[model samples]
Target: MNWVLLIIAGIFEVAFAACLGKAKETTGNEMISWYVGFLICLAISMYLLVKVTQELPIGTAYAVWTGIGAVGTVLVGIFVFKEPASFWRLFFLLTLITSIIGLKFVSN
Candidate 1:
């Protein structure tokens, strides 16, 4: 259950990061709305992370959560945001994902 919350938190972290980028690209009212969404998503992400850390070790939880967020944010940047997708970026994203899975396997 804690892991589930952590994953959800990571997803929300991705959402907030994307919203932040979108907000930066917009102007005035649109930017304001996007910024608001980013804040809300960020709050939820942090809340869930707090929940996960209640039972999980802070070091492991934080590392896995951030790993998921980084990979997810990069994927969204590539797909929805249409940012550049260089070979090394994809390679490192896969490597991060592999490490995340490894963490899950080794963790109790």
Candidate 2:
């Protein structure tokens, strides 16, 4: 359950990052709306992270959280923002995903 919360928190981290990206591309009310969304997602992510850290090892949880955020944000960049999906970028992404899964397996 803690792991589930951790994953959700990481997903919110991705959402907040996406909101920031969208905010950068807009102006006026839409920009404000995106910023608001960023704040909300940020709060939820932080709350869940704090909640899960009580049960999970801090080092492992933090690494997995950032790992999920990094992997998810990169995919969002490639798909939603149409950023470069170069060979090396994808190669490293695969490795990051592998590491995240490995952490989950090795952790208690």
lDDT of each: 0.95, 0.98
Using all chains and alpha carbons, the TM-scores for the candidates as numbered come to 0.97, 0.99
Model 1 bad stretches (over 4 Å):
none
Query: What is the per-residue lDDT of model 1 for residues 1-108, given as tens digits with 9 covering 90 to 100?
Result: 899999999999999999999998999999999999999999999999999999999988999999999999999999989989999989988999999999999998
lDDT of 1: 0.95
Highest TM-score against the true fold, candidate: 2
lDDT (C-alpha) at residue 65 in model 2? 96
What clash pairs does model 1 have? Answer: none
In candidate 1, how many clashes are counted?
0
Which 10-residue window of candidate 2 scores lowest in summed lDDT? 55-64
Poorly placed runs, candidate 2 (over 4 Å): none
For model 2 the TM-score comes to 0.99
Give per-residue lDDT, candidate 1, residue 70: 98
Best candidate per lDDT, number? 2
